[model samples]
Target: MRKILHVDMDAFYASVEQRDDPSLRGRPVVVAWRGARSVVCAASYEARVFGVRSAMPAVRAERLCPDAVFVPPDFTRYKAVSRQVRAIFLRHTDLVEPLSLDEAYLDVTEPKIPSPSATATAQAIRAQIREETALTASAGVAPNKFIAKIASDWNKPDGMFVVRPSQVEAFLTPLPVAKIPGVGKVMEKKLAELGVATVGDLRAFSAEELQLRFGTFGRRLHLRARGIDERPVQPDQPVQSISAEDTFERDLQLYEFEGDIRRLAEKTWLATRRTQRVGRTVVLKLKTAQFRILTRSFTPEVPPASLEELTSIALSLRDRIDLPPSTRYRLVGVGVSGFRERGEADGQGSLFDDGERSPDSTGRPESL
Candidate 1:
């Protein structure tokens, strides 16, 4: 059996800010740009007590914790810290899959440095991180990735949990169905209607029955209920797509979408720079006030050479919408896909196409 460890930093961005400035310690801290459209990137444990969370509107975060300290993100500093954490993981095992700057999955089944157990490996890694970076991390050691991820979150802020192969089922049974990776509010409600509220309850349904309802995801649910996840810790996974989106506090007319589209386009473009791959397609996603999603995509004759070119192509896609001028939208997104290594030759393709549709239970466009 493969041994997996999920290590997650405690309130990563906010913790970094606090560690650098002692005065900010023990106070509610929110990491975000202060603006109407800005979203919270991270929140300290103190801020979380007031319901502040990442991806929440910065304005709402402020409203939730009026005394919360707001700090703008510093990617350069965060990346440096991430490198240090990754180096520490390499000391124990080379099989490391980073989920973000704050968390990663490590396969320490045959660790570089011998340890008594996988749990011991995790404990040592956490200790090394604390000593090297002065940051606290929580770890979950399990037979596979999914359970490890869930276990890592069991105790917040600096804790560890271990699940032996023999203990996997017992460890997952009492947990809510929401603990399943893709079981969001909508899916959880659907499962509840079927008298399936917990992982234990989910076991009563056959795999075929779940597949009939949720397609491929249903099969995944069946396995997850039994604490089975066969996915390996793949190091250096390539970027398939990058996108940025926002839901407006109030619905917006299509004509009024320019500012938001431009903003999201810029954000998406900046994010793409982190990867060495070049994208050939630019996608524009829109959601109606009633939650109907539509997407438009374009594959340029040449990959967008600069941000201005990308933003122009994204903005021009607006003219292709056939909706009435009276239509209002609740969300807008800008994305790039069809990634290829740098210097790849461009392939001939249609300039425009109606993007494929696959709406998840939450009635939102499914991520690629």
Candidate 2:
């Protein structure tokens, strides 16, 4: 069995704040910028006691816990800490797949330290993280990602749990179906209607029955409910797309198009920087006042090599809109797609090739 470990930081941002500032300890803390448009990015365990949560409006969080201390997000500091945690992980194995700044999956079936078992490797990694970063990390050890992810959350705020291969089924059977990844509110309700409230309940339905209800997702759910996930721990997974979108507090008229384009282009650039691959197409997505969607794209002679080029091309496409100048919009987005490794050979010519291009190019990026 492949030994997989999922490590998750506890209330990452809030915990970091509390660790650095002793006064914030034991107090309800919410990490967010102070503004009407700001939302909570993380809440301390104390704030959670008051029903505060991430993504809730800062105003609402304030209403929930009037004494809750609000702290602005410091991505730079968090990223520095993440690097430290990663360094600790690398000491054990290079088979680390980071899911986010504060969470990752590590395959330590053959660890560098020659641990006696996967659980020992997980404990060592968690202990190293705590020692190096003064931060607590919860770890779950299992045979696969699905089980490992569920196990990691079983114990929280500096805890560890392990699910042996033989115990996977019994361990998952009693959990709510919602515990399965990707089973959101709608999917949970649908499963409940079909008497599939728990993993064991899900197994009562045949694979064909699940397929009929959820299309392709049904097949995967069937396997997962039975404590089976064949997906591997892919190291250096490639990114599929890069895009940035923003929702404005109030609708904006096209008269302010230039400002909106600039803002969205900046956001897109920020997202692109996070991925190592380059994109061949640029897309502009606009949401009108009535929520009608309009999209324009451009595949330039030379794919943008920098954020400035991306913004310039995106702005040019925005100017091509046929709508009346009075068009009002509530959201604007910029995206880049058709991503490929920098030096990887693409069947199609280089994005900058001057030869005949595909008609679908429309000098635009592909859609979701």
Candidate 3:
């Protein structure tokens, strides 16, 4: 069994504020910039007690937790701490896959450390992070990403959970369908209507039957219900598609989405460049207030030569929305795919020249 560990920092931004400032300790803390449009970047366990949450409007968070101390987000500081955490992870294994600034997945099937087992390796990593960073992290050790991610969250604020290979089914069976990754509220309600409230209940339906009802996602649901995920912990994986998205506090019509789209595109652009890769396509993703998801993409004869072209293509894609003009959207995302190694791709080439594409490929995706 491959040993995978998921490490997630507890209340990363708020915890950082608390660690740096003693007075902020024990008091509910929120990370945000002050403004009508500002959103809470993070909330401490203390603040969460009062229903404060990340991505809530700062004004709303303040009203919910009046006693909460607010600190502006310091991404520089967080990035530095993240580097330290990554260094700790590397000491054990090079197969680390970072999910974000505050979380990563490490494959330690053959650990470099003197630790005797996967569980021991996780314990050691968590201990070193706490000792060095003065911050708590939660970790989960399991056979795959699906189980490991869920196990990591089983305990919060500096804890560790483990699921041995033999216990995979037992660990997954009793969980609510909502606990399955990708089964958001909407999917949960649909599953509930089918009496598939738990992973066990979901498993009762044949994979073909579920697929007929849910399309491609039906297969994913079938596999995840059995605690099976074959994704690996790939270190320094090549960047293919870079994207950014946001969920608005209030849904907005298409015209009102222009500013948000541009902002998200800029973020995606910056991220894409950070990978030192070039991309040839722009993709726009949208989710309606009712939870319907749609995506539009364009691959220019020439890759977008500049940010101006990127933004223009993204905005034009919005024009293709055949839905009613009144359709309001709660979320939008912008991405660049069909990435090429720097100076490697020419206008005549395609991203799939490698013979076949892996499901995990982030390169130009096929249009639905």
Candidate 4:
């Protein structure tokens, strides 16, 4: 059995805000724009008491808690703090897989400091995060990712829980089926109609039965319901794609195409800098006011070598949308994918280099 640990920063964005601002401490705070269309990005525990939650419309959040303070998200600062947290994880083990800016899974079967057990290692990491960043993290230690993930969320805000191999089944039974990953509101409703509201109920279904009903995902659901997840912890997972999207403060006319494209391209470039990988394809995504989605993609002879090139391609793709100039867009996004290292091509070279030769033959330097 592998020793897996899930570390989740508690209300990460809200905690960061509270850590930086003394006055915001212990108050109901919602991180979001105070607008009708804007949704909450994060909410402090104090705000959660008033039914405020991430993704709740700001207007509804205000109705729930009239005095709730609203603050815009600062992803840059959050990302910096995330780096510090990741460094803390690295001090213990290299088998760390980041799920997002604030949560990650660590396979610490062989920790750097052998004195502490896996459970203790999780505690130490969480403690170090609190001491160094002045933020709290909840940790879950278990034999596998499925249980470890659930354990992390069992107790929130500076808490730690462990699921021993022997106790996995008992621990999973009776838990709501909705707790299982990928079982969203729709799935939950469907399960409810079938009286499968809990993990125990799901366990009663055979893999064949689940597969017949839900397709391939049903088999996954059956396995997960039985507290089994065989997926291994993958470190330094390859970046399949890099994209940046923005929910505008206000929907803007598509006629404002140039400005939106430029802004989105800059955002994408900034996001890609973190990976330092060259991409062969560029994708542009747009969401119209009517909630319709449009996408355009391009693969060039030479992938964008600079942000300027990326911006030019993204802007050019924007013109291909069939929407009228008067149409309004609620969101805009730019992305680059099909990453490749120099000298790495398909068949003769790296897989990503298939049919495309690098401008320079010398291999690209490995990123840190």
Query: What's each prediction's TM-score?
Result: 0.81, 0.79, 0.82, 0.77
Best by TM-score: 3
Ranking by lDDT: 1, 3, 4, 2
Per-residue lDDT of candidate 1, residues 1-368 (tens digit): 99999999999889999999999999999999997756688899999999998867688899999999999988788778888988999999999988878889999999999899998999999999999999999999999999999989988779999999999989989999999988877788899999999999999999999999999999999999999899999998788788998888788998797989899999999999999999999999887765567889899889888989889989998888888999998889999999999998889866665743323322211111
Report the poorest 10 consecutive residues by lDDT, candidate 1: 359-368
Per-model C-alpha lDDT, please?
0.88, 0.81, 0.84, 0.82
Model 1 alpha-carbon drift over 4 Å, by segment: 244-252, 257-281, 285-332, 340-368
Residue lDDT tens for model 2, 144-206: 998999899989978999999999989988999988877876788899998889999998989
Candidate 2 overall lDDT versus native: 0.81
CA lDDT, candidate 2, residue 320: 62
- Which portions of model 3 show Cα errors greater than 4 Å? 243-276, 285-296, 300-302, 321-334, 342-368
Q: List, residue by residue over 1-368, the lDDT tens digit for candidate 3.
A: 79999999999989999999999999999999865556688899999999997767788899999888989999889888889999999999989988888898999999997778999999999999999999999999999988999999998878999999999999999998988877876788899999888999999988899999999899999999888899988788677678888878788999897999999988988777677778987888887766567778877778887778899989998887788999998878898898987777567623321121121212221110
Q: State the lDDT of candidate 4 residue by residue for 62-143, as single tens digits.
A: 9999999898999889888999999999999998988888898999999987846888999889889989999999999999
lDDT of 2 at 279: 82
Comparing 2 and 3 on lDDT, the stronger one: 3
Clashing pairs in 2: 297-364, 298-363, 298-364, 299-363
* Cα-based lDDT at residue 350, candidate 1: 64
* lDDT: worst 10-residue window of model 4: 356-365
Q: lDDT at 19 for candidate 2? A: 91
Could you tell which candidate, 1 or 4, scores higher by TM-score?
1
